[model samples]
Target: MAELAFCLPDLPDVRDFATAQAVQSGMSEEALADFLVAVNEVATNAVTHGHPTAKAVLRMWSVGRVLVVEIHDEGRWTPETPPGQTPPAPHATSGMGLWVARMVSSDIRFETGAAGTFITMSFKV
Candidate 1:
């Protein structure tokens, strides 16, 4: 098992994490691209919606053959439309982030509260 942890202030850090993870994994260029996209989508969501002053701790570890990443944010979470249903058009932008995450990640689990939000996304690495 391998694990990495980082506390990121904003978007750039998110991109850097993606790059570092790809390089460290020695993944194919194509897989790296997907990882980058996934990280951006999730990190952006946390920064833009969850918390502005909050710090995000990203942790990655291997479980057997799968790669798992957990993103924890110290920010309040607002209620949104449920998954797998068409949300209102005005709220489309909010949902797109999650949609992108789902596209690239093999699995995702999220828990939110007044204190903060925690998200875990897994990939078949």
Candidate 2:
């Protein structure tokens, strides 16, 4: 597995780095696009909603045909439901990041506690 630990200002760089790694690891074109979108959404949420001065850690690996990416943050924020489980109101605009992540990834898991929040997303390569 490869990992990137970053601060808020490093968000864009991390996105590009993750995408490049995914491509090198053999993710298909279509899957790469989806993975990029998903990772961006999660990483953005980590920086914006997480505790002040929080940092994020992103890890990735490929097991056979599956590509897994995990994003973690050292923050106390916890969602009432796993992101994307509930659809926001029609007029809502800001809460859809996790929803989009869920739609693009093959599977997603979350863990939150006093330590922080961790989001693991898997994709079919």
Candidate 3:
């Protein structure tokens, strides 16, 4: 098991640390890059639209044949299943971050309620 916790601010430091940690964990260069991108998208969304004073917590662990990454934010944002069958257009620049995360990771889930919002992703090892 490998775990790290940090109260990341809405700044560049958040992205840097996420990239470093993923790379240090022996994740493939490509996997690490994808993980960093996904984590940043979630963190940025929390900072931008979730709420003020939001803090982030990240945990990574291995289970059987899979590696799991979980990110939690102290904000009241709910995750909804986009009501569509088709993915966003390739030319679209926005509204595709979460879609990308789901595509790269084997599994991605979001939980939200009065407590907070949490995003979890898994990759096959």
Candidate 4:
């Protein structure tokens, strides 16, 4: 597995790096776009909603024909309900990041606690 651990200032760089890593790991062109979109959305949320000075760790790995990417943030924020459990209201602008991520990824899982939140997104390779 490969990992990129960073703080808010490095969000963009991490996104680019993660994309490159995913492509290099044999992700298809279509999967690459979708993976990048999902990564950006989750990473953005980590920085915006997470605690001040929070850090994020992005890890990528492959198993069989599946590619897995996990984004972990060192913040205490927790959602009242699992994101994307239901579609967001139609006229809503925000609150769609997780929904978009869910739509693009093959599978998504979340783990949260007093320490932080960890989101794992899987894609078919």
Candidate 5:
């Protein structure tokens, strides 16, 4: 397992952390690309949309051939629409992250409460 505690300005480092963990899990070249895409999108949302002054934690682990990543943030955001359920409009500029995450990752889950929000994604490595 690997973990990184990051802030908004540490987005690049978040990618590095996730890349390293995915490599260690024996992810394939093609799969790694998709995995990073999802990681970048989710991590961006984590640091930017989460609570002010909040610290985000990213965790990566493997179970058999599955690679699991969890991004946890100290925020209580209610989604305006069900996230990752549909792709963004063709002309839309933003709001593409969640939908893209769903397309590339095998499984994506969201949870929020007084503790914060947890986005758990899984990839088959």
Candidate 6:
């Protein structure tokens, strides 16, 4: 497993770290680009929206042919609408990250409680 501890300032670091792990996990060229985009978006959401103190952790690993990347924030939240269920309106200024994540990742799930929010995204390797 590969892991990174990050905050808002570390957003760019998150992408660099995750991209390296995804490549090692054997993600295809096209998929890897999309996967990195998804990873960045989710990581951004975790720190900026989920955590009051802006701390988050990201972990990546592989099981069989699937690559899994998970982001965990330090606060609890449940969205008013299921995240990524629909695209944001054109005039909307934000909330497009999760939607982009869902479009690219093979699957995604959310688990939130008093501990925090964990977003697990899977990609075809």
What TM-score would candidate 1 get against the native? Answer: 0.73
Where's the lowest-lDDT run of ten residues in candidate 2?
Answer: 74-83
The pairs that clash in candidate 2 are none
For model 6, residues 1-125, the per-residue Cα lDDT tens digits are 88899988998899889888888988888887888889999998888887676679999989999999999997887678778989989899988999999999889998899888899999999
TM-score of 2: 0.91
Task: Find the 10 residues in a row with the least total lDDT in model 4.
Answer: 75-84
TM-score, structure 3 vs. true: 0.73
TM-score of each: 0.73, 0.91, 0.73, 0.89, 0.95, 0.93
lDDT of 3: 0.68
What lDDT, from 0 to 1, does candidate 5 have?
0.91
Off by over 4 Å in 4: none
Residue 113 lDDT in candidate 5: 90
Q: Candidate 4 at 55: error in angstroms?
A: 1.5
Best by lDDT: 5
lDDT of 1 at 64: 61
Cα deviation in Å at residue 20, candidate 1?
A: 1.7
What's the residue-level lDDT of 11 in candidate 4?
A: 78
Misplaced by over 4 Å in model 5 are none
Question: How many angstroms is residue 104 displaced in model 4 relative to the true structure, after the best TM-score fit?
Answer: 0.7
Name the regions of candidate 6 deviating beyond 4 angstroms: none
Per-candidate alpha-carbon RMSD to the true structure: 3.6, 1.4, 3.1, 1.5, 1.1, 1.3
Distance (Å) between predicted and true CA of 84, model 3? 9.5
Looking at model 1, how many pairs of residues clash? 0
lDDT of candidate 6 at residue 123, scale 0 to 100: 94
Off by over 4 Å in 3: 1-11, 78-86
Per-structure clash totals for the candidates: 0, 0, 0, 0, 0, 0
